[model samples]
Target: MTETITFNDLGLSEGVLAGLRAVGYETPSPIQAATIPLLLEGRDVVGLAQTGTGKTAAFALPVLSNLDPYETKRPQALVLAPTRELAIQVCEAFEKYAAQLPNIRVLPIYGGSAYGPQLTALKRGVHIVVGTPGRIMDHLDKGTLDLSELRFLVLDEADEMLSMGFAEDIETILATTPEEKQVALFSATMPRQIKALTGQYLRNPKEVQVKSKTATAANITQRYLMVSYPQKLDALTRILEVENFEAMIVFARTKSETDTLAEKLRARGYAAAAINGDIAQNQREKTVNQLKDGSLDILVATDVAARGLDVERISHVVNYDLPTDVESYVHRIGRTGRAGRSGDAISFVTPRERWLLKAIEKHTRSTPAEMQLPSVDEVNATRLNRFDEGITNVLAEKEKISFFRDVVAHYVSENDVPELEVAAALAAMLHGEEPLLLEPEPVRPQRQSRDRDDRNSERGERSNRAGAARTNDRGDGQPMASYKIQVGKRHKVEPRMIVGALANEGGLRRADFGNISIRPDFSVVELPADLPQEVFDALAQTRISGKLIELAPDRGAPNRRTGERFQDRPARKPRRKD
Candidate 1:
């Protein structure tokens, strides 16, 4: 193995070196070690490295080192990221590395943030400006950003910018910059577009290429939980209760989901916060600082919001929603298992998305081990241990609790209750009405009878858990309506797809849908017999596999005229059991 290179040996300015020491950063990463010297030498370079490869420092340190702090605060260096979160992260890094340097100001400008502050900062002057391509273009069009004196220009995550359809904006902003300014472009992959842009801008650039690793870090314990759509939130809370995580980042699919999940976690007494594009820059900065200082335990965020984020305390990463692509999946989990520390990554996969899970495995060349949810006993044990620890802590603070102990003693005497009983009452008060232990889902046995009468009886008893039901006086006395959908084995329709479509489009809970029986060209599903016409209409318009769902009343029996035997029908399969 090659010898590790220290930051001191990288020839960084004394001010930058002091800042690095203050943050406990000693050695440089491979990309940093290779690119810093080239950047300091004012070479236009192209760096190929994935997220979390210390790419930010590879460029930021050298740019800051060469900055003239006493010069007129017109922006001297420009860094453009793909997303607002990444721009903010990169800007913060510049600030950290330039902390000991006087008269240096770094500003981050991004969309969804108020323009008043950005305008003020621009008017007051800043040495460095880091922003997303679109926002940077906005500034350039308005003539608010001055790049005439810019000595360094960095394009971080160039590939991601193109993926987000910002190529035009990027090119427009690049065209506005001075031709003499030194430029650096960093990206995980060099696609044709990025290559074309580099060819157009960079002049005989030095290429520092770091091969992408397909597999996840070996130090990360990767696991997946197969769950239904409805039970995912509950399942996440159960895991959080039992797993001893120092800090965690929960990745969701949308900004609304991040807000909803964060709110739910906060109601459960967790120090949780939501970080998304909608949040103001100052608020987002404060939330990140809180996470770093041990004040926040959980961060609920979307992919764009959490990009390029690095927190040493993040011991766990939970994929609340799977990404649309395999590369995104790897990037999402990459938030953890960083800084040479062992971390855990757990993903919740619904049955409909199992194919996605398999694809991720194939792409990453590693299979995630299946994990069982914590048993009720395990959860109870964790709760009891926490209660015991609380008691122990209170006992340890004897002097602080002496007055409270006397008051409790007086209450016990006045109420003529034993001290143990009083203590039990106090414990009960501390633990709220919500059950301390979760109830395991009940298991159902397979139906055995195949006779005509038995088959009819079984169909009658099927429960419609998703919608309103009317009792069938003759059978199990449950309300359920059976409907036929135009999708089956021929269409490659799976039970999970039907369930996912209904739950997603009809605004119904997972439990609303009951039994599903797939046939050659059509499938039958049981739902609350009294479902609103609006919901049923919505379901009819929902598309699966590019085919609109055609739902109608089930003809009690599939035209027996065809003489198809009841026993010849394929057995029903549950998508997943909660």
Candidate 2:
């Protein structure tokens, strides 16, 4: 039997392995599997795949593996994404994968934010930096950012960057980097501009192309919802409130799931029914007739039972469970947009199944617009409008509601209450214990403050599943504070880099020259009095070779860096001779 390839088989650092487990990814995507080994072997790579492919992880993982953060704290790996959103996204991915390796630091730099923090983060020493081309250029021009020590460079979405007219900026940035560094360029299409770019910058690159057969449905409007399996019902219920779908077919994977989902939908008063392989032909036909006659609003069914089932009233198709193969997905959504009518297809994908989604998109040649789960407040507003419309619609039927009006008027008089009060009371009774407005969605604890450049408040709604959980962002309003760590070192690290991490963490000027000593096992240096606690914690947790550092107190120190009394480092000279 052929050996099954997995992430475990890939030569990854333990931290990367822990990250894969945390993010719930079991197998590598085609792009990742093909590109990882080559990049890890110090070969430049060219990846050709659509957006949803696992491109980010493919390069990010290997770069993280090869980095020696403690030995050299400056930005070693730089990734240039096309936009602020993608930069933030790629930065967050780096942070997540480097979670187990607390010593490594990552930052996102872009144009809109103030430059103070970006310069500060750079000074403090970062292992990886993800940013847009424009901002990176600004830093390079200002001499605030240095790429002299850069070991790896990645041009993510190279085609998009060029389309956005970052072609010149990309070339300038590429020219600044050392020629010895490994470079990777990923793009969906290779145009002449991109071809010329690869030829000029990339050195004998190994092309890793992942192509899928084209499948198109021009008439169908496709969208995808990123929700967990348990949260699907909540999402479906809220979607039903906002959608004006006349009839929908919800596809599930198995017979039991179809039956259970149908029962749940009916319990919510959706006029829903189920059809599966086990159902009798007579009952199936009856259900189909009811759907066609408008008695059924939704039909939940297994793929096997849904075959050859067509109804003109069907306006929507929902993939309750994603199909295992591309053909299956195409066939499921194909149920709608039939004949001469246009239709909608919504697929529910769990966060971890993003790779599968990308694969489906690449095969179908249709980019499904990402969807946000409706907010409780938004749903409540929708309900209120619907309720008001219901009453206004009823009130329009003057002849039909006269008896109900008389009953309500008599109740108001009997209870000695105003007509409005009577109406409110009646609405309360009709809704029973269920509140007309749903409680708001639970808020997660805030980690990093939103950056000034944040276009959206939350992550997922604006992101493509691979998004910002806690941005490695420092707010402008935050005092330009410094952070550092103290630990007993068990492994070898460059002494200058350690001091650089300390000096930058505390925002200490180059003149803060206190004598520093370097020892074999541990090192001691004077810390800035104004160093931030966050930086202190980070320094304390930072591990070199998976071992913690020993914190050394100043002047009348207990233990000292035994190597020698280090000389004061000079200040950096001002910029842009090139």
RMSD to true structure for each model, in Å: 14.0, 18.3
TM for every model, in the order presented, reads: 0.50, 0.48
Q: 1-578, model 1: which lDDT tens digit per residue? A: 96767998989999999989876679887889999999899899999986656788999999989988887558899999865556767887788788889978899987556678999999998899998665676677678888888888899989866665567667877888889999999988889999999999998999999754557778888899988677888899899999999999999987899999999999998999999878887999999999999999999998778878899889999999876556567777888888999999999987546645765786577889999988777888998899889999999997998998999989988989898998888778878797666676566654446786476864554432222132232245445667778878877778876775565446555666778899988888887665566565555445444455676555454336775423333322223222
Candidate 2 worst ten-residue window by lDDT: 464-473
Query: Cα lDDT of all candidates, in order?
Result: 0.79, 0.74
RMSD of 1: 14.0
Query: Which window of 10 residues has the lowest lDDT sum in candidate 1?
Result: 465-474
lDDT of 2 by residue, 47-68 (tens): 9987656788899999998999
The TM-score measured for candidate 2 stands at 0.48
Candidate 1 TM-score, C-alpha based: 0.50
